[model samples]
Target: MSDQSALQAVIFDWAGTILDHGSRAPMGAFVKAFAAFGVNISIADARGPMGMAKRDHIRMVGQAPAVAASWEQKYGRPFGEADIDALFAAFEPLNVASVRDHADFIPGALETIAQLKARGLRIGATTGYTRPIMEELMPLAAARGYTPEITVCAGDLAAGRPSPLMMWHAMAQMGIWPAHTVVKVDDTLPGIGEGVAAGTWTVGVTLSGNMVGLSAEELAALPEAERSRLRAPAEAAMYAAGADIVIDSVADLPGAIERISASLKAGKRPGYR
Candidate 1:
């Protein structure tokens, strides 16, 4: 609530930030996708490129040296476009089928978004899922009363996260200009990079995202000291990757925005501070 330009909008990343509390679906899909190609990857590898478009993410994993080596051993050739397509094909149905199961709204996500909308800030969302996956997710999320005014999926843009096109698309569709007036909330490094590339205040959500990848129940089961121990590195990684601020979850977003608003009033912008 500084005298600076009023916060205009918040662009959220779908999976971990709002729906799919722990961002679980994509990781499993990516693992299965690679397994179909005879490339076995650890969950850490699967999560490495989290927040990029699904196809792009598959391609990235396929191109990794270990995966590529596995492919070379399995098929006597390098991983290529055909492999990427096959992996994506295998991944799509599994992802689509399980998306609904993961569609539960993260606790406080709807409430936080409602609060933002009440304050007159536009709600927009961008996601790594393709339009079809979003088609599945949207109605489920809407049924829970957490629909954004604008949603731009991966296939809808020429490029996806870390490229900033999806963010730009959301801004354009919402008719919001001056990127600094916007805030981007995401759960992964690539998503943070997208916001930085777009020159917006970027807030990273830790426990609910790729970093922790823990369900609310599971996270709650951990002792307080253990939870803090688990969160520190993920927070550090996000900050090092260019997040302007990092919070525990989307529930903490309003406070992050208030702090960012103060900075905006002080003439700070992403990459300028």
Candidate 2:
């Protein structure tokens, strides 16, 4: 294989991609944070902006048509930056507190990390989570043996996912270059878009991430057909978001990597039709 085709790094997203099955931490926090403002947001509403910076996420949620209507009716004003700030302030501590409780590693995460490390692949991470939130979750993840060489959080950069900046920062900090030589694994549309914008191959995980909203045990209890039925929309959305591949979880990542390696060897870029 040519050097250009040899993958060097894997940049993972936090929350859904690594810890937090169903990416439950932030969703609950988002719902409660909005509720605190007397504006109720459903889980689907919170999940809509899953992979962006928290402030951006809050802004998007506030600007959602239904949410905006509720905000106007309740407060007699349009949702604006001040509203975003207030919501974010409310969200911060709730997210920070909840992240620790949800920091259990996704199934196969440890094994995948070990395999990637064994293959000498560099490990780095990016997240929509802010530093304070990560500060709480990282130690717990570390205790479970899943520390990445670097973690780039939401506020660490001037911008976050779907912008390519955070992913670029993670790669730059790790001294890994030529973005195509890295693969990004994430579960959210913005997360996939980040990889695509960064010029790396992108893989999206559906069932284990926000798409299915089921824990490992919960998912295991479902029949295969039921699981597939639930996962279809996320899978389609991932492809629509320009993911090169989509899998049920990180458990299937190695096989996806093999397929991506073959494409790399064939001189294909991400999102190749």
Candidate 1 global TM-score:
0.96
Which candidate tops TM-score? 2
TM-scores for all predictions: 0.96, 0.97
Which residues of candidate 1, in runs, are more than 4 Å off?
1-4
lDDT of every model, 2 decimals: 0.87, 0.90
- Model 2 scores a TM of 0.97
Candidate 2 residues lying further than 4 Å off, grouped into runs, are: none
Tens-place lDDT per residue, model 1, 1-273, is 322377899999999889787799888888887787667998988988999998999988888888788889999988899988888889988899888789888888988998888888888988889888888889998887877898888888678889989898888888788889999999988899999999888999999888899988898899989989989999999999899899999999988888988888877787654
| Local lDDT at 162 for model 1 | 91
